[model samples]
Target: MKNLANNVGVSTIGIATFFLTVVVVVLIEHFTTFNIFTLSFFIVFPAGALICGAAAASGYYFGALWLHRRPTILIFVQILLVAAIAQFAIYYGEYRLLDLGDGRMASDVVSFKDYLDVYLSSTHLRVGRGALDTGAVGNFGRVLAFTQFLGFIVGGIFVFVMLRVYPVCEQCARYLRILAKKTQLFSKQEDFTRFYDTVFEVPVDGPDFVTLMKWQQEKDEKAVRGTIQSETTLRGCPHCKTQRISQEIKVWGEKEFRDVPQLTRHLRIPDGIDLTSAFKTV
Candidate 1:
């Protein structure tokens, strides 16, 4: 029952943000002639559309943060619906505004399909630093249709990525509070290996865990050849105080550092164990 209430609250927030984003975007584009929704790269990737979609769906992000709850699949589907409607609203708003600007009294009289056809007919892709016009490719209407499809895809992808990337406390239905994070740099692979074993092999409540968690090192440019970097993070549920630890190790290459996925680990601390005291120390 509580989850149901949360879902309702989040949905309401999402709807509100969606409308606000649409109005702001439509008005900005109408006045500036920027066509933010149709902004693209290489005539395919909807870069501008992604920004607009994410803006429209931002309620989900803030809603989850404010409510301290993870969004459900139902809310995700609602965002997609918003994305579709947002695309239509953008184009329709543009059409109406253009007619009004032309001193037409009956801008509402034209059907949407007819307006879309006219809009596509007049549109052409420009390329190169010289802004060379590519003119119309064969069947320009189909091309524009595909671009609209990409807009929906951008919206869906943005929300989908946000849902997965943010960590949440499932049992408490709240986002985890990050307790501590530190990155340690090692001049030797063996040093990092020793650190890794100390973390994974020992119980987290032990004194060694406290000492290791406080470990720090300053980077030395002289030791570039065998250097490794390890990042450690601790998160706890605000309500339940359930704690989790995650670590990722990266090897310094000739040019950059790359993750060693096999060396990564995420562990849940046993119940009744609270490491807040250890983290409180410098």
Candidate 2:
């Protein structure tokens, strides 16, 4: 029942956000003479469309955080629906608001379908400082439609990716609060391995664990070839008081630090475990 109510609330907020985004997008395009849905400055890259999509997807992102929504297939479908509706709303809103000279509104004279056809036929691509001639109206309209659709789909996928990466407290039905983030650097591979073993192999309340917790904070810098970097993130559920720690290992590459996927680990901290001393700098 609680989840249902939360879902309803999120849905309402999302709807409101969708309308707001549509209005803003329409106004922006009207005043600026820039069509975000079909904008592409770089060759084959729909930068403006993606930005518009991100704007449209913000509602779903915040709504999820409001109730700690776990992204499911249903949520994914809802996001896509929101994307489709939002795009339609923007197009229609723009059509209605358009002034077709001599105090005439586009919507007052023509139906939405007719207006859409005219709009697409009249649309031209802007290249640099001049307009680029799109040979045929039909081909240009098709390309525009394809770019807009692809951008929204990619935006929906990004929302899901973000939600999945964030840690959530399933028991409390809330997003986990990040407690602290600490990093440890090692000059030798064997030293890092020992450090890894100490943290993962030893029990939370063990002597080695306490020793590690008391270690002084280290300054973060670019890793050298022989150096190993371990980044630890601590998060907790406020309601249930459950804590989780995740560690990611990185090895120095020719230009940057590359992640060691196999070295990543996530561990649950027992309740009542005092972590204050470990995060002195936090």
Candidate 3:
């Protein structure tokens, strides 16, 4: 439960930041004419939505990765929450700045129904609808709201597809880190055929060298002739419990080692040349 909250919290913060940025940019454009710069309001909303969507998607992806959980439902819920918060902020900010003189707060002006109506309206989707039809003088508010909502959905899908292709374990309900990995090898030979195999395992740490040697010996004794193997690994976890072990096998090869040169020849220090002077200088 704590892990789930943490993931949601991270995503919320990310979405909030994106929302704030978009609201600020929109406010700036609303107050001033970017006409001098030839930047269209139409371009601004879609581009901002795309950028915000991408940012939110990244937040969801990393949050799920950290918690080692599938993000299907989580991402959807987060997007809805973000959309609500962003709509409120955008509308409230606009009301405070523009409609306060009309004796209505942003909260009073915007409602869930308004958002729903905008999101569901198909008028904006018509091919014949031009900028004039959807401009601020027309159904521009609905169009803007819908575009941003679409951005969030598109962003979530992008992250979902990417995660599916590069899969990770979603069994553990808590955040996890790689603990340890070990490789075990096995082999067999026949007069008419030959085969080699490798297996991997994650063993709890604590057995002494002698105990491990004995265990290896026992395993070897029970194995058929020509079956030889070695194991190597390191492991740890925040909860001090083993979480996962991953393994891969390749053809065996001869052991290799690197030779070290003696360092004694390079260890000599100058014989008390300036010990007293060096200490005084320090």
Best by lDDT: 1
RMSD of each: 3.2, 3.8, 18.3
Cα lDDT over the full model 2: 0.74
On lDDT, the stronger of 2 and 3 is 2
Q: How far is candidate 2 from the true structure (C-alpha RMSD, Å)?
A: 3.8
lDDT per prediction?
0.75, 0.74, 0.43
Candidate 2 matches the true fold with a TM-score of 0.78
Query: Which parts of model 1 have CA positions greater than 4 angstroms off?
Result: 68-71, 99-111, 136-138, 164-166, 170-173, 219-227, 252-257, 280-282
Worst 10-residue lDDT window for candidate 1 reads 217-226
Model 2, 247: alpha-carbon shift in Å? 1.9
Candidate 2 lDDT by residue in tens digits, 108-136? 89999988887766766656666666555
Q: Per TM-score, what order, best first? A: 1, 2, 3
TM-score of each: 0.81, 0.78, 0.38
Candidate 1, lDDT over the whole model: 0.75
TM-score attained by model 3: 0.38
- Model 3 C-alpha lDDT per residue in residues 1-282, reported as the tens digit of each score: 876686667676557655655565447745872211111244434545554555544655665655555656666666545543553454455444544458875447666455445433533322233534342324554555566666655655666566554423233234444433333334543311211121111122323322332232334443343444433322223342323433232333454321222211111112222222221221
